[model samples]
Structure formats: C-alpha cells, structure tokens
Target: MSSQAEHPKTSSSPVQNSIPASSCPQKRTFSACDLNCKTIENKIRKKIKHSWKRILKVCKEKDISNVGEIPVSDFLDIAGKFNLDLSEGESNQITAKYDSKKNGTFAYYDFLQSCVLFLKPKETSLMKRVIIQKPQKPLSPGPQTTSFFSATLRIQPKILHCWRPMERTFKSHDETRSGLLNVSDFKQVLHDYNIDLAEEDLFNILEYYDKNLTSKISYYDFLQAFIQ
Candidate 1:
C-alpha cells in the first residue's frame, strides 16, 4: 500500500512543474502590462504639467482672481483656448462635476481634469503631442457668423457670464464709438482689467486679433479672440 501511494504522488511532480512553467509567462505578461501602465501614467503627468502652465498663463492674461483656479464663468474662455466645441450645457456640467469645492472656481487639478475628462489612457498619448494652431484670419461677419456669436445671453445665460461685463468694458474703452479699439486703448483696457503683461506679450495678443495687422481691433475682434 505504501509503495502504491508513493508511486501516485511521484507521477504528479511533472504536472506540477509544468504548471509553474506556464505561470512564468503569465508573470512576464503582468510585468509587461505594469510597464505599459507606468509609461501611460508618465505621459498623463507630462500633459498635466503643460496644461497647468497654460492655465496660469491664461489666468494671468485675463487677470482672473485665483491664479490656479478657474471660475465657471470662464469656461468659454477655457473652451476656446483648448479648441473645445462644447455647448453651454456641456460646459456647465463639466464645471459642476470637477468643481468639488463649489466655490465658483475649479482648483488647478480640477481644471486639468476638465481638460482631459473625456480622454482615456490611450487617448492621452495623442493629446501629449498636440500642436497649437495658429490664429486664423478673422472672417467677415456674415449671417452664419452673426448667428454663431449673436448675443447668447438670453439663450445660454450661464455660459456667457462675462458677456455683459465684456460689453460694458468694451464700450467704456471704445470712446470714439467706432466699435473698435486702437493699441493704446486696448492696452489701457487690459490694464483696467488688471492684466499686467509685458509690452511684447501685449503686442502678440493684439496681433492675434488684428489679423489685418491693422493695429486696431473691433468689438467683434475682441469677441472672437477672447470671448468666443
């Protein structure tokens, strides 16, 4: 009986060894997967860093109160900056989801989250190498363009939180009633808004809107470059 029992146990050794050999590949696969995960995580972190820089730059340029936080009212500005064609309701929902503090502002990390909210790990790799587009020449106002920018206040009041204020601000600076602002006037208004930018940066902002290089910007110009 003892000899028979020993013989049966001996036969199981080869099978047990084969099981461990098969598991070696499974372990290697998990190891490779872990490396891939780390690579993607690193890419995400890099994108976050770049986004943070952009957020700060925009906040400084716009003179937003909280340096690292973005107000819900500025969602349009963010959307425009990032080329996100989000609707008013979509902007509101995104803000509500990430703005956990409910302080009318999204924290820095929250802003980053908003920027990449819809992207998965694979998608982030594409985002990491995205190139900034050059500002396009301002198209002449047509019916379609007019409808696109037509005072969205009544239709989507929440999204255009800064619309009225921008109107008032623009009017106050547009002393000639030309519905336009020259470089000096533009600089002064930005100053009034507390945007303390260097001379070169200010010129660059003006150039972006002054596509004709006319050294002046119209109300529509301002709306297109900053408000839309």
Candidate 2:
C-alpha cells in the first residue's frame, strides 16, 4: 500500500481570523436627526406643561380614585373638555406615548412628569415656609353647629337683587345640562354676579351644598337656599 505524504494542517489566514471592520458592530453616533427629534419632543412637553392644571383637573374629575390613569376614551374626552384640539392622529400618538402599560388606559402622572417639573418636598422649603407662616383654614366646615340656611342669610342680600340673573348664569355654566356645577364654576358664578363672601364662608356654603362630596352642587337647589 502506497502511503500518501500528509501535510501539516494550515492555520486560518489573517483575513479569515480577523473580523472585517465593516462586519464589526459600530457604536451609534448621535446625529442631527436625533437632535431634531429631541427638539420636537421638548416642544410637546412645554405645551403639555402650559395646560397642566386644566388637564389635571379634568383628569381628577374623571379618575375619582386618583389612580393616575383613566380609560383611553376618557383621556380623549379630557382633550375635548380643555379644547386641546388634538386631531385623530395626534390623539392616537398621545395615547400610545402615555399608555405605558399597554392596558388601554393613559397614565396621567407619567404624562405629567414627562412635561411638568413638580417640586420635590426637599426642594419646596420656601413654599413650606410660606404655608407655615400663614396657615390656611380647611375649606370643608367642621362640626355642623350652625344651620346652612343661617349661613346663606349672610350673603342673601348681596345675591337677592340679582337672583334671577344669577340663576341664568349658573344654568348656562351647566354645560352638561346636569343642573349641577362644579365648585370652581359655582365660585365663578358668584364672582360674575358680584356677590362676594369671605373665603371661609364661601367654602362653608360649598360644603353645605356639596354634602355628598361629589364636587358638584345643584344650582336650582343652591339658589333656592339663598332665597329661603
């Protein structure tokens, strides 16, 4: 049998052993496109912060539990309530951006934080000092020692002359025709009618009228109390 001559196994060539520069993964560099995207994102955030209070109020009205989230439909309704004027596509984009859980609900607190810079407790020492210097009285009345009707008597004369017009104004603000107005709207009606009362007294009236803590007072029932 003829023995064939065996050659030593050749080692991998440099071209084969070394990875090509093109084939190796490269570190991503921040480009102008990325900068433009960041600019647009910041603009959206600024706009959101500008309307933060109204958005929060509407969200609170709908999310009574204060879970910091609401159904997508309610979230959209909030836009209409505050006249955000979001187009269908814009609304969809917002929902997608804030619905982090993918559960069909928008997390409002997440959205709020993305735009609004809330002061931390440690950062609000100045505000705390101001509050401490002049403590605010609770808006809700404590112990029902006095009758509500008696309380109304104080503001009666002021509202008495313009009572009918005041009723009309209150009804007009009842945009939902629910015959009820939220606390802010009720206060606004009183302001428009030029019926002023001390803050404590105004809150006392609200507490009496909003006994259920529903944040809504029936205008008809409320106005009748003033007359009586």
Candidate 2 TM-score to native: 0.35
Clashes per model (N, Cα, C within 3 A):
0, 0
Instruction: List candidate 1 stretches off by more than 4 Å.
Output: 1-163
The model with the greatest lDDT is 2
The candidate maximizing TM-score is 2
Predicted candidate 1 versus true structure: per-residue lDDT over 24-133, tens digit per residue: 11233645644443344344444543454565456545545423446666755765675555556455544544454566664433344323222121223432343222
Candidates' TM-scores?
0.31, 0.35
- Candidate 2 deviant stretches above 4 angstroms: 1-144, 147-150
Cα deviation in Å at residue 39, candidate 1? 27
